[model samples]
Target chain A: GGIITQTPKFLIGQEGQKLTLKCQQNFNHDTMYWYRQDSGKGLRLIYYSITENDLQKGDLSEGYDASREKKSSFSLTVTSAQKNEMAVFLCASSIGLANSDYTFGSGTRLLVI
Target chain B: LAKTTQPPSMEAYEGQEVNVSCSHTNIATSEYIYWYRQVPHQGPQFIIQGYKDYVVNEVASLFISADRKLSTLSLPWVSLRDAAVYYCIVTDRTGGLSGKLTFGEGTQVTVIS
Candidate 1:
């Protein structure tokens, strides 16, 4: 019965600019994840955190940084925005380490001009 | 991580039954088949998950054969709102501690009037 909330539904940034997306979950899950989805493509993992102050990189984590400031919040930063880049960033959380079901946020649509 | 294959797209009429299949030939004993649905401009939502046999919830039913090489997500009485991209994911048991969930090019289900 908890919800995952992502701030700034839409973001428009210039090339080389830095942008940040934030996520909060009330489920008290131990695992939090960040994923990026491009047009006509499936999602790719960006970064994730298993606990507060813990970080883990994923396949597409080169251009991003993540922070788990607290148990209820996780944030992602686009180090440097690329021109013509447009994608949706999603945040999700799960309860345990094995066979956990994930709950996701609505997503933040980013458009880099 | 086990690789998964799913249909690119499917079309169904309202009130019809729709079945989307996913093939994971290398699925291991510890791996689980998970189904998620993503509406346009939103994050994916968990539909169902199963290791083998059949599992059903209020949203959808997951059917896994004895061999566990393939799984099917059945949506009964499809409605307009059911039009969305459905993703089948195989979780790596060892990677959950890092909060990673690999996603494939999900099957897009379009409900026609």
Candidate 2:
């Protein structure tokens, strides 16, 4: 069984600071995605990578940048953290098929002070 | 991407059956319905996906209507650990990053002892 590992399970950043979240998947999937979930709300897609070095912006891509450094690694960067901004960032991967199932990481909880 | 609607919350007791319904009035013929659940402080986990008719897996059973406008996820013998938010999403045949899966506020299911 493969696992999606997210680094720094908890993050605290100052207002206007830049933050980066990293994800690693052993599934060797061809597609990776980053999603943000606010407290008491559903998740919103931030960005996704279809292959290495390929990036696609989702509905919530503003203020965020993504990097598909390799096939198994995808990173998300917050350009400028807002004060009191708190959310959980989730990483997921899939085989890039028409019926491939998605695997998700535990998540990175971010809190901006 | 087809919009989905689910209940805000539902309550159930241990060993009881829990059925959550989702409505997608404008679902396309090529679209598929998917279910996912999220526990506290964790990322969403995929449960099941189906194009039409009924589909079952060890974790849950999905029943889709003839018109594909409605689908239900049935969880048998609920337990406390099953308490979480359940999401229903509809996406096209092109899965992965190209599918553009959108997650709306899902149903919060509380399984009590």
Say which candidate scores most in DockQ.
2
Report residue A70 deviation for candidate 2 (angstroms): 0.9
For all predictions in the order shown, the interface RMSD in Å is 2.4, 2.3
Candidate 2 docks at the CAPRI level of medium
| Global lDDT scores for all candidate models | 0.89, 0.91
> lDDT value for candidate 2?
0.91
* Fnat of model 1, as a fraction: 0.69
Clashing pairs in 2: none
TM-score of chain B of each: 0.93, 0.94
Model 2 misplacement above 4 A: A97-100, B95-98
Q: DockQ of each candidate's interface versus the true one?
A: 0.63, 0.65
Residues A1-113, model 2: lDDT tens digits: 88899998999999999999999999889988899998899889999888999998888999999999899999999999999999999999888846436788999999999
